[model samples]
Target: MFSLIVGLVVAVVLIVLNIVLSKLSFPKEGRILAILVILVGYIYWGFEPFAHHEMHPHVEHASYSFDGKQDIEALEHAGKDATEIKAFWATIAKIAEHKGDAVAGKALVTANCTGCHSIKSEGFPEIMSDADAAASYGVTPPDLSIAGKVYDKNYLIAFISNPVKAMHIEHKYPVGGEKVFPMPASDFMQPQEIADMVAYLSDAAQKVPAPTVKKGASEFEISKAVNKEVFETACVRCHAMNYAGIHAKTTAEVMSKYIGATPPDLSQYIRSRGEEYLHNFINDPQRKLSGTGMPRVGLTEKAESQVVEYMTQIGDSKKDEREALAPKVLIYLTILAVFALLWKQKIWRDLH
Candidate 1:
């Protein structure tokens, strides 16, 4: 709607300018070119809204399917040890130390998560297309290849056990008028199994090597490269960043249909949401907005800080350079203005 209004205003201004120019002594060729530009711009404005209609696709409210009995039965079949599971849950709740067996985690991941998520670079074929997955769950399940690297182990364990509960999201429809929680709680899996999954992810995905910065590169440039990698690996799956020139149109369309809205562009998100708000929200969005469709991506303390810094830098990349040159620019402009005033006075005095 904002884009439409801006396009209309631009088209109207161009039309008015063309009319005014027609009455002036502008060259025929220049007049024709200007008129043509205005016509083309107006034509584009007429179709601009439809061009991005996929960004705001209509969503229908649907019933969620949850079977507590079936989930309990599955948990029983998995040989859940109640005492061990309780202890593990308690440890995670208290943020206490607990050991996880990556070997056991690999087995658990194969048995449970492989159906929905792919871990390695290549091997398992995707069971569903992006559209199909979005239709089923509001968003495509992201690849888990680097999950361990991006997310904290404690958060990962808690999330895997009960995503909605861990994130403090309400288990209901219309969370922001069109949002839904599609990822089910893994309560069916024993707490030990959840820890094992986190263990495997930590071993396989955590601590992605930073991009090498060339010697004498600016801090902004190096930070940009690192953050670009982070966004591509984790964030580009859902959000679009126009400044970075990333757009996932098809994915956004399907997601809009399922989740009731496309994920917002992140180009100015840091500026709009502010650093503190983003920190808490990114840590756990459901905690901030109880029914928000945004999931916890499990960023660790360091990774989260880097992500925020990268976003802030990109959103206002020119700010530092602009501030550094402001005083010099003002001095130069003042001298230029003084010279122009003197020249004007000299010419007018001679005429008088």
Candidate 2:
């Protein structure tokens, strides 16, 4: 309604401006150009409210809740020791090795996980594209083909059980605020079901070769390299960087179609979000903006720090050099101002 009023006012103002311009003593071409511009402006103003309404349609968010405290209590009751989570996973792995059913896991994956994630090069036959998925869910769901190797089995179990808890433990980063958009807990799944899935993932991991590590790089270089790898695996599907030749035209169109807004480029995200906020947001996006499309990437503390370092370097690589030159520039300006004042006084003395 406000947009409609503004649009109406703008249309009126354009009409008045057009009338005034028409009466001006200008050349025929100039007058025609002025009227055409006003017409275009009026048309845009008339349609802007409609476009605005379409872009931001009124919709109610469904009421959803998660009881983290209850979840923790349940874990405690089940003798799930946080310190021995890995040991628990080892036991599960041993059991799964003997009796876990890969066929059952495959059925579960097809029914639940296939909706958002794909294990193969060809993604699931969904209505939206990979870009759309990323726009909707913060990042595209990673291929599970190598996920078993990429993440620890213990962490995987915890994550599958309760993603929010796992993420909090891994990064210790807060969300935007109190509001959170946590992944739905798999509390519905039975222990046997989760174990079967784990078995499938572990077996899949064995089939794939391990990623080769590049050696001899400096710490900064290593951070950047890791950041690049992380970004490609997680972020590249959604957010694009100018340095990486990923830019507005491609991402903007896809994002606007899916999310109603384009995600900001990471090239200067550090400047906008800052280190602390970035850390917090990366850990849990819901803490900052509850309904935000950005999801927690679930990076470890070290990985999160590396990502921050990478963003900082890319965002303000010349910050140190710029700061170093500040004092010298100020001194030079001070000298110039003093000389200018002296010259002005000398020039005005004869006049006075």
Candidate 3:
């Protein structure tokens, strides 16, 4: 839980003490104590196997202009669809070069996407109901009302061009794999067409009210519902958390067909995977597990944090209690250590 910082700090202190002790002569009875300190320091930073460097996990993270740095989208370099990687990159470049016509995009949306989706704010209701859509496509299609606002624009552009490339799931594109993606790639549409649809969506989404900041509600409000909305919107489409009474719209079997395996219920993930891991994984699935069926979900930092907090609330109900008791437990241990040291000194005094 300390993330090895305490261990490293203790090692450093012992190393410094070791240097000072090396210059002094310890009493014969106390010589073993100095040796023990040196041995502990060696284990902390030394004693690596010959291939430790090679086998150690090289956990790397990729960033984008979304992180407020520059315009490098990490997923742009991920899975390619056959020999079309070059063309896909060029399409992305073209999409960036061109500005979309929102009005024209609205028409393109009517012609192309409204069969599965709905933009009620723009007077386009879903052609298929959730039940009907689920039966036909194995999962209900999401409303595009806020897609432009919530999703990363670059990701949206790439996803519209080719989902297989935007999401690193080329493994599922083979002959026997789940080749039936509900949202087909808009191969008939050029880069301009793709941008226009996104533009219409982006333009339309502005009409819908934005999601709450949620941090204040999670803290002072403590309603739990406010914090959980992020998880519901971002995660509930695919994964279920049965313990939290959150079920996926699609059945487990159908979800397996979509992603090669049914996504695991995220009930006990707070226990199995800590908050740090959840943050990284939620931000970008490929960052933690490359080629995962899960896409980047494209949540802001606040939304992502809310999901973690929701998970903590559901799965880690004891967190507050545990935190309150931690200091008392540490205090007891410190007192016991002090007593042990005094007893050791008393015995040594008698021996000397």
Candidate 4:
């Protein structure tokens, strides 16, 4: 449009110059200049539609989002956005619908939280601190699990966006120390981003169990009980499913003695010892069952009993049954091998 106006103005100036020059008797040069200006204006007018702005036409489509919605309709579907970019638009759809965007929330967490607190292949705190809330970062990163139990969506967003609003006397840190650690104020986060992050955190937090209390003990019976309690309190941190396998290292000895390498069958111990003995072993494994990596579990007698009762009562898979099933597994593998060989050499390959 600007070019068109400029071309018109130039054409008018050329015409006026031509008239003036003709009156002054320089007709030939003036006519040439006027014709050039008119030609330029015609070219500009012909290309006027291209002057609006260089915008590629847009196309739209349907896609999925991490905000718990699927197959959201998309506007402006054109672009190299069909791959991972689709995830971003799906998040936009959720925000449009007033639902929270967890994928974007995860990005926010990676940007903000990963430096301090992280989960397996997820986000920060590369190594965890063994010390309690009395340690650094002032207050421990609250187990995101159950955060929503204590905090509402608005409360979480507000606290995360600017914790100073919630950082009054009762919530004040320092606990008698000189240093005061507080959540950093973020003008960096968008209001909707904060909302999405809070929503994501709330959902993530809900998947985790509540924090448990640990108590100390010394005797074997007490130690096993403590071990059980410790398993609940501390061991669960590294070992999921009562040390069945989660993060535990497999023993080559067990495999050499039996089949290859696998975790020892713990189902037998739980059944034979009747939970109490196992609890003691757990409480103080070094003292009671020396030369093992099992850490001492500081457990109160009541906590030990609770742990004992829990193990004995729980209907876990039986070791004997699993062992018995092993032969059947071997037989299935043998049959599969025979069939595969027959299929390859005798029939299927030739058919193909």
Candidate 5:
């Protein structure tokens, strides 16, 4: 913001300088050259602000963050966020210590989770279709086919234990961070049981690889479609891009209440917020906006890149055309300025 303000100040000063130079026998062409010289600094400052902005969440860094490498215990059984965070991480730490038995997990998951979720590649299908699921739960449950491969290992464990707290959407969900979520918290299950379920999902994901772009396919189709699957897998539950003809499975009114407001139509957000902010915001929403209902969607880094690429393609692909035109505009101005300077020199010599 400061840089943009400074750049505008410099631009105003140059316009004033051009007016002064015009009266002193400098031709318009010569004034163009003078203005261009003055603009070099403005060019840098004007564009620098958009290149990147370092943003951090309002939360104090040390308050709730944990490295997970240390032995931590709950300092108290209280309602404080700090204490809750410590307990959460400590539980995650304990879960990490156990090795999962996928065979045992398959049975447990079938009994506990398959009613809500489906592992299609493993031949398990949910009792209800997506529409019914949305009607029943207010959001269609995501398939678990790629969850193991695409989500962060730590995040998956945390999500299973406390969806509201782990996703940082407690403001929208129940206070205990346990009941009433689309998927009930498995806090009753042992940490090892949770790990086993994660392991079974991971093993299943590995056994059946995800769809891939075919070699020698049309680049036009490939470029547009490559990241789309990733976007759908990660973002299409409650958000929609109407320009792209992608509708949310959950209706607007349902999501409006679910998240405290209808989520914005994300068609032009790339142009509005730019890619850098989206990257950081998606990585951790609370960092950018405290109490934001958007989850810290636990996509792996690669999947996050793919999702952003898809958003950029649909939201602001014209940015390339605008960027491509800028240099040509600058070049044309330089050529015109050169001609103006030459004419000014001739007139000055003739006056002398």
Candidate 6:
């Protein structure tokens, strides 16, 4: 988190430096070189692949892979009415299906995509083949060949224009709630261009079946560990400790007065907000609730969700008996660990 803040500061400084350098009376040749260097550095900084590129998996047979060759054949083989595309997409499968033109789609992708994307030869992480390109973009662009097999024309057209609206649950980096990074809004692209690209991508995705799901056991374990850390730092300060609400006797008494004005009890808040709002508020408050007293508590989406889940489970109970017990357990465990380590090392001194 600190590093991310520092990086933002560094980026600002570099932008200022670039602006300053432009006004200086440098030689024409030197100025040109400086501009070129700055441009290159900026691109590298944004992409980061130039410095530490993750290598793309290589395609085994080069000659076999043509622009739309395999994709077109796959779509053709899948057949029109009988294919899974019809089942999945229903009426929306017609646009790609009607044209059944992989060649045109590939041509469209090549012309419009090169600036942001790369084919086999160009760019740091060479998009080795169709699979390579799809993976890099973070979702499978439809296989034009098989695209007609699945979605109807309307779905394809709508999807090409605005990906965020189309694949909210899938394509995006999930940050909780409806909030996400403003991404490649395809509004500027000509209608024909979007149609062509959609024709290509939708057709392409069909050729490839869904990628196999990786085991998330380790990921789940890490999430649990991070959740505990987040809870300790944030929630423990308010809910568990006496610091949550107004200065009254018990937490229940404090919370009764603290309902609207103060940060409400986490136990109650979780039930009121549900998982989505709670998750969003933890990651970024502004996106979820209006006039949220909760400051942006620095926790990742995954961690926030996990902590919320943990809290919600406890919310079923009304008692505050476990509140003070958690701290006692922590202190006892800390003492035990320290004494055990000291005894193991034979470092225990006389209690003068």
Which candidate leads in TM-score? 5
Count clashing residue pairs per candidate.
4, 6, 0, 24, 2, 21
The numbered model that scores best in lDDT is: 5
**Models ranked on TM-score:** 5, 3, 1, 2, 4, 6
Model 4, range 1-352, lDDT digits (tens) per residue?
5655776786687678656756775568666776677677666655764443333222221111122122122223333334433454344344344567787887887677655555432334444553432144433344343343334453355456445322222123324544344457564666677767767776775555433334553333453443353343433332334343333222233223221223333434566654544654654443333344343333334444555554543323444467799999999999999999987877766787
Report every candidate's CA lDDT: 0.68, 0.61, 0.71, 0.47, 0.74, 0.47
Model 2 agreement with the true structure over 1-352: per-residue lDDT tens digits: 7777877787788788878877888888898998887787667755674685666453222111122333344458778864444444444344434455677877777787777776763244554666666566644566676566445554566567766555443232244544333245684677778777766776765675433457776655665665655455555556777765654323566555544567788998989877867766775565555566554555555556666777777787777679899999999999999999999999999998
Would you give me the overall lDDT of model 2? 0.61
Tens digits of per-residue lDDT for model 3, 1-352: 2425655676778778877776777775566677785786467444453234335454544443232121133334444233345556666767866799999998899988887777776788978766677778867777777667656677778778776656656665642564656678775687788888888888987787544555655552354665665576678878788887999867777777667677889999989987867877777677678778786666656567777888888888778889999999999999999999999999899798
Q: Taking the tens digit of each residue's C-alpha lDDT, what string does model 1 give over 139-245?
A: 66777777787766766776776675454444434245455466666767666677777787787764445678889998788888877766665677688788878
Let me know the TM-score candidate 1 reaches against the reference structure. Answer: 0.58
Residue pairs with backbone atoms closer than 3 Å in model 3 (clashes)? none
Q: Considering only N, C-alpha and C atoms within 3 Å, which residue pairs clash in candidate 5?
A: 29-340, 57-287
Per-model TM-score, in order, reads 0.58, 0.44, 0.68, 0.29, 0.73, 0.23
- Candidate 3 — worst ten consecutive residues by lDDT sum? 65-74
Please give the lDDT score for candidate 4: 0.47
Q: Which stretches of candidate 2 lie over 4 Å from their true place?
A: 1-140, 145-188, 196-219, 246-250, 318-352
